[model samples]
Target chain A: MAETTDLDVAYVARLARLQVSDDERRTFQAQLGDVLRYAAKLAEVNVQDVEAAAHAVPMFNVFREDRPRDWFTADEALQNAPRSANDLFIVTKVVE
Target chain B: MTAAELPALTISELQPLLRGGAVSPGEVVDALQSRISEIEPQIDAYIALDFEAAKHEANAADLSLPLGGIPIAVKDIISVAGQRCTCASRSLSNYIAPYDATLIRKLKAAGAIPLGRTNMDEFAMGSSTENSSVKITLNPWDKSRVPGGSSGGSAAAVAAGAAFGALGTDTGGSIRQPAAFCGIVGLKPSYGRVSRFGVVAFASSLDQAGPLTKTTRDAALLMNAIAGVDPQDSTSLPEPVPDYTQLLGREIRGIRIGLPKEYTTDGIDPQVKAAVDAAVTQLQALGAEISELSLPHTEYAVAVYYVLATAEASANLARFDGVRYGHRTEGVANLVEHYERTRAEGFGAEVKRRIILGTYVLSSGYYDAFYLRAQKVRELIRRDFVEAFKKVDLLISPTSPVPAFKIGERTADPLQMYLADIFTIAANLAGICAISLPCGFATSESGTQLPVGLQLLASSLDEARLLQVAHAFEQSTDWHQRRPPL
Candidate 1:
């Protein structure tokens, strides 16, 4: 039996802070299940004792000199937002 | 300025006219705007085209840049300084970028006007632009069908005569597939060939920035402008960027071109097969040697790509919390709900599905069975290309199995959608260089007329050689000259 449920989809969306419509929730539930159906093929291989490979271009723990650099200013950062309050993105206190 | 007559003059041809004072950049920009207005109702190529701003840029650019004033389109996922970088997601719909992407800076430095951000699959997650949260981008070749995506908007923009060239990102064939579907040239350079500093990440591991143009030489020219290391992205290669255009006229006299047997196996389109074979023959005529090569792990490409891409998407998307520039839900009293509601509302079905699958695969219990094993398979797939590269200078294959399908054709089936990218995804996974150029025509199941693409791939840092092959074949064919009936 598949280990997925409508609640799992709803829960995941909730965790992501997205408000999905009922139609969207149903669409995602089925689509996500089908996507997982193909993704389950990874379970067939034996990966014990194998090291992990992350980035396609191989790099390991890329380090910088730790010198402080002045990144974009707060005013510049918020320049493109539709709304901002006190140098921060303005959003409704969205919690249930 | 109908689409029929537009394909004859490449960006290189048009730029010179603008530069030599034979034509004003404003005239060219106006011609494109007029054509876009005429056909965009049916094709739906652009999410936003800043025609007024572009005209201003073109006027200013004529006096400053080398190309008098060539207009360029940017994939929606990338930032253009102060413009909106939506990635076709509602989450960032209200967000505008604070700075330009490295390539956008480079394009502007070269005097290209950014018309506006083109539409894309939401978060650059799907093969078809149908996954876009904003709006769907249709193929310019046949308005009813899909332009290969997440760069679908870029492809459609160029295909429909909205612009001469455009920039696109490729994680899993986003650039090449759409270019193929739209009958243009798309190049995905070596992983570090272009910096990803301000381009929104979908799958950082395999994601790259490259060009979509009307010809391979234009791709090369754009590559020359865009390719290089940047201080912003540390993984960017520090090597000197080579001159790609100079290599076009040179003969590939003794270069070895390899045809991968796995690519030509069952389920291959007969027309695509014939077209690629003819391209191979043309390469031979151009004094290049051809050989049959085998990549045994070809079947594992899709499996490897999905696992790795999703795992990265899961991590990269975590930054879109309510605290940032993107959308945040209101009326939720708590912080946790803030994150949940914002994402649930912002992300599309495909993105939500992938995030869940990605999270599930990387979760504790399934880590060993899924993520670790998939990494090992990735190593094996990369090795297959490395071994094949030792035998041949370049690999040839059909870019997509069939031509473009209708808008709703494969939307219902998830895996079937993924199958379209089977051939083009391998190069991204392997971190190699690949180019897709127009090959010939493909008749769809419904008797629709579409164009097929032939992909030329090479090992890492071999873009010069790949472009040489593409440019050589393009010299022999008139397929690149064909455009939409509009």
Candidate 2:
């Protein structure tokens, strides 16, 4: 096993837009440390000239002709919003 | 038809009966309702059921169409218009799908009825269905044990005869492992074979929606209706679709199978190895040549899978901000606080763990060491399969290291739970097709006999050959014919 360093749980959580409690921060830090340690095994492989595969199949520039088609109506798009007013999503005031 | 006969009928068996007017769709639905009412309470396989709606659809169904009137369970992760597609999470518990998924539209066009929404791991993250916030789904074979997951509900429902067949999305063995645990047939089609248009994203690169059925032929039957390209999904393949059921009962005289050496690594239970070995012998007897092969990078599959899957999941799941359709936190001071609180409160522990792990790997200074390295390793894993296929047409292994464990056995250790998916995850990572079906049984320490699965894998876009050989093996054995005592 590799000597894995502890991850900054609070910092990562902030980037992920998740508010972590103190206890959760401790738990995640230890757990993430263990997983990263296991994941360090990837470094043992010689990937000298191997290309990183982002997609399973080789796909490039998959585009269809730019044509307008029927899409979800505004009512359908906003159907699931928890709070909506006047056909717009209601959210906390920005630009204070 | 007698009530006992209804649950045992496969899709092929019911096709003629419905077409010839020997049985009405209403009768089929009634029989299924009786079976569900009896077994559903004990198994907890369904998150939601629309029996009245299904009956209405059944009554109006055109009996002339393929798959006409067959009731199929839809995993909650897939969209069913006007239905609650919760993905077994509290985050979207109240959200209803605005429109049908591409697969759903196809199934409806083929005259199949959407039976109900099935439970799954929250965000399809965990191996066991215990991660579901809705309820723990029990194995119909033994209520004390789990039906393997994250497709546990669909597998359990099929095993319990609650639905004729079901659909499940496989990412890291979510479908196959559960199907194995429940002693049913499950297929994870090649990544692009099935559209992911409205299937809730877990690990986008790994997820493919496939069928879970009582038999291999039934899996082929469902695949015929649901497998195709969709304009809505850019990742969908433009490959020509074939009638998967057309070649059922085909001969497999010259098929070559490879048994990888790495799958026999530590932690494989003796009973599971014995069952899969016996299955290989049985296939050999049916005239398919078998050989030993090696995939040296197999040991690193689990490690590489976690890095890439979590990274994709973290990005995909970021859409669930409180301002949108999912659960939202109240009394937040600002937009940032609202986003933070909503995510913290909405997601479960396992989901949050992956999110943080993903966020960390994709973070600055760690991207090269973690994410990029894992992707390169992933390429090697795919290359291993590509090379192995040169020697043999397909590979065989144990779907899981062991049968279903006690419900709460591995919940305390996420690593232990992740290991349950070891054998099935590689196929997904390679974007290849694979299937799991009953091979034999494993007796537990308590004398409970649980089902074991034998997995078969083929190279990408070789589903036709894969199904042909699987159907041949299935027809020769009685394993798929057995049902749970439930």
Candidate 3:
């Protein structure tokens, strides 16, 4: 188990793509620190031979025969987009 | 029956009236619309209502279908084609679903009208609707207190007679907790029993859409339409769907019911404990064999749930960047700034808090300690249920540790609010079917009468037996018949 410590809220916020204000950073740091401390209880449990379960019920991969089917038109697909031009979603420039 | 009396009828009761030519489906919609206009100011249950379109659909409803002519309110998170699927977040506040969720499609095929979108905790994050970016849904029983949340609006709408039934998604006790608070029947079918194709994703593995209604039979009736495999959601099970109402009036003789010792601890309110105890006795008198058992890992559920659910949430919510849909920041220099600012502006505080926590737990070095460890502990929790179910057909407990608390009560402390779902979270972790129904009432110090819920759990895909037992208990007690003073 990794040693528990204060959460670096600013760093985590940046990683999450969420811009946190200075006040929010301070509040979140304290609150998340408390939650992490409570979550540290899991470290005490013996899990030597246990398998990690990503889902509660066992699931199997489902596949269907490859076939072309009618789906959303470009207009329907772009209906809720924040910005769209032609048939594609518009966003901030990625490459210079 | 007069139009005023139509809102008080359950889906099952309304079906006969519609079939027997006594009432039209459009009249039901109008009655509910009138009721909504009268009580909605106090409850604030619905986020949006489109009765014009609902009445349009109701006019053509086929009475031959199972749920014919019933108007089921939908939680804002589920897509219903043209309706706004805001998820009670500013991020998706103006967004409209381009297509219906598989569950909505099934309900429509069963002749049910999708009435309106109800409020919820922002992105289904908090225990109380106070976390909702839209509005807080007050408990219909006591307007000063909260309708326990994420699905608070759905439960309150049903309890207040503004909706015949409603759809709610449960990740960790969202449906059951609110239902317990509002004094209604809420079912969380076993994971993967319902499709998640168009429902907004929270914790993908844990979330299941189910019914919030006035009675167990109504839940069973709604469940019959919603449960089944869907090609759109890969995780949905391929098992044969059964008639959920098949065992409704069957005798529960010799049915083994277990009471978990871990759940009977001191944190539970005394009134809540007494209600569940009396419910156990009632079930015993109805011929169920009650015994004490242990699901030893019960204490770690909230901890494990927080870590895993938040981790999954962080990944799932990444789709909300300012590109394809929803909110977009006006001024930004580049892609990175656009992503950051848009999310910061769009998501509410609780959603942001969870996103940060999720990212941290799944971050470098701490992954093994928090994320993976929680998953392993999650396995242990599931195993505990598996072992206990071997000795009993079902388990019983209080859905929430306490009844509906004051609106601003737990808002200051997130952990305190998370603890309110103590009893209901374990079933989601264990991938089991569970139901919360009205068992009794708890009177607050201020002299407000609040509803207490009795929770029943059965192994995965055993909804038939779960509904049977819940129906038996509900039929024997007058609890389901008690109406709020609205």
Candidate 4:
């Protein structure tokens, strides 16, 4: 089993942008270990040389013409925002 | 229409009556309203009910389309022109979509009325709708137990007869597992069979929208209306979309069905197993050739599913930053604080955990060790199905290991909860077509009877064959008509 540490859990939470409670942190460290341990079992498979099937369908640049087409008005779009100001969604100001 | 005392009506059954001028769209919507009013408090299947709009649409209905004014619920993850697409999270709680999902456009074009948005696991993350920030979507048959999720509400709505059919996205069995737990018909077409233009991304590689209905033929009909390629969704498949309903009575005689031995492993409930076995017997009696097969790599499916799904989710959800739209938090004085507060407030526990795990695996030091390795395993898993299909015409399995459990049963145990999808995740991983339908009943201590489902999977673009087999089995069974007590 690959050894997982609290640092790993903390780093992950940071990346996920979540605030993990300290009490939950310890629990996650252990839980994350178990998950990684189980996932580590995949190392046993011999898939060398097999091409990965990343997306289900083949990819191509399928962009359509950038012609202007009237869609929902900006006012209609902002109608469902819980809080709005000046015809745009109003959210808490960034600290910076 | 509590699940009980109501025999579920499929779109096919309602469409003819509705189109032949025997029934009005208003009648169907009104009947559904009464059903929703009777059951919403107990089942909590819908989050937003658009009765006024539905009535307006029904009154002005055009019956020339294939759907013929059938009422349908849109899973919260899917967007509708002027309706909220919450994806069941506080951040997107009031996010009324600016445009209709491609499928919703098709439904509207086909004359289907939008009943409402149904509840789901927040951001389509969890197995059961327990992670819904709003409320638990109880299985219609047993109010205390959960309807499987993140498409749980879609299943519950269909099961409770609130709608003839509904839309759901399958990202690691969201559609099928819930349909199994709720005892309804749910289809997850081959990964790109249907466009994903407006279905909130859970795991981009695996998310594909399909139908949750009461009958296989209805799933086929719904899929027919939504399966064409969309230039809007680059990932949508270009395969020819055949008329699946027309293929319903197609012969499956001498067709080989593979029963993967791994699916019949130790932990499956005896009742679920018996129900699947009985279905297999019924299929055999109807002319399908059945054989036991081995998918030795099956043990690795769940592990790989979590790893890859999370990795993709982390990448896909990165777009929900505080700046452009969605929720934001105040006070911490920086971009980072805004990002942190917004996401923490926006997402639920299971969703947070998955994002964290996904981000971790794709992070600097772990990418090669975790993400890349899991990708290789995923290739092997896909190959396993490819090789298996070479030996059989299709495959069958118990949709879920057990019937739906109580709402809070596994909420605290994330790993235990993830295990609920062990059976259905393989299809998403392999990007294949699959469906789940009621097989029979299972008695539980939750003061109600529950239903289990038999799952059918077919190779990509082979949905017609899958529907033929499912329709054949459904025709031979009476389970689909059994309703829960009010």
List pairs with backbone clashes in candidate 2: none
Q: Which regions in candidate 4 have their CA more than 4 angstroms from the true location?
A: A58-68, A71-96, B1-8, B445-447
lDDT of 3 by residue, A1-96 (tens): 555574798999999999999988888887888888889999889999999999997777679878999999999999999999989999798898
Docking class of 1: acceptable
- TM-scores, all models, native as reference: 0.92, 0.98, 0.99, 0.94
Candidate numbers sorted by DockQ from highest down: 3, 2, 4, 1
Residue B481 local lDDT, model 4: 79
Question: Model 4: clashing residue pairs?
Answer: A95-B333, A95-B334, A96-B333, A96-B334, B3-B484, B4-B484, B4-B485
| lDDT score, candidate 3, position B457 | 97
Model 2 stretches astray by more than 4 angstroms: A1-3
| Tens digits of per-residue lDDT for model 1, B1-486 | 443444346788876667677667777778778777887787777888778888887777743465448888899988897787888998888787888899888878877888867888898888779998878888877778889798999998888777788999999899999998999999999998899999898888899999999888889878888899897888787789888887897778899988888998788778888877888888888899999988877787787787778878888899887565787667766777667777777777788777876766676565656677778877777878989989889998999987787888888877788878899988987899999999888776667669889999998888998898788889878999888777
- lDDT string for model 3 (B1-486, tens) is 799999999888888899999999888899999999999998999999999999999889899999888999999999999889999999998899999999999999998999989989999998888888888889999999999988999999999999999999999999999999999999999998999999999999899999999999999999999999998888898999999999999999999999999999899999999999999999999999999999989999999999999999999999999789999998789888999999999999999999999999999989999999999999999999999999999999999989999989888778888888889899989889999999999999989899999999999999999999999999999999999998
Candidate 1 global CA lDDT score: 0.81
lDDT of each model, Cα atoms only?
0.81, 0.91, 0.93, 0.83
State fnat for each of the candidate structures: 0.53, 0.79, 0.91, 0.48
Candidate chain B TM-scores, in order: 0.96, 0.99, 0.99, 0.97
Best-fitting candidate, measured by TM-score?
A: 3
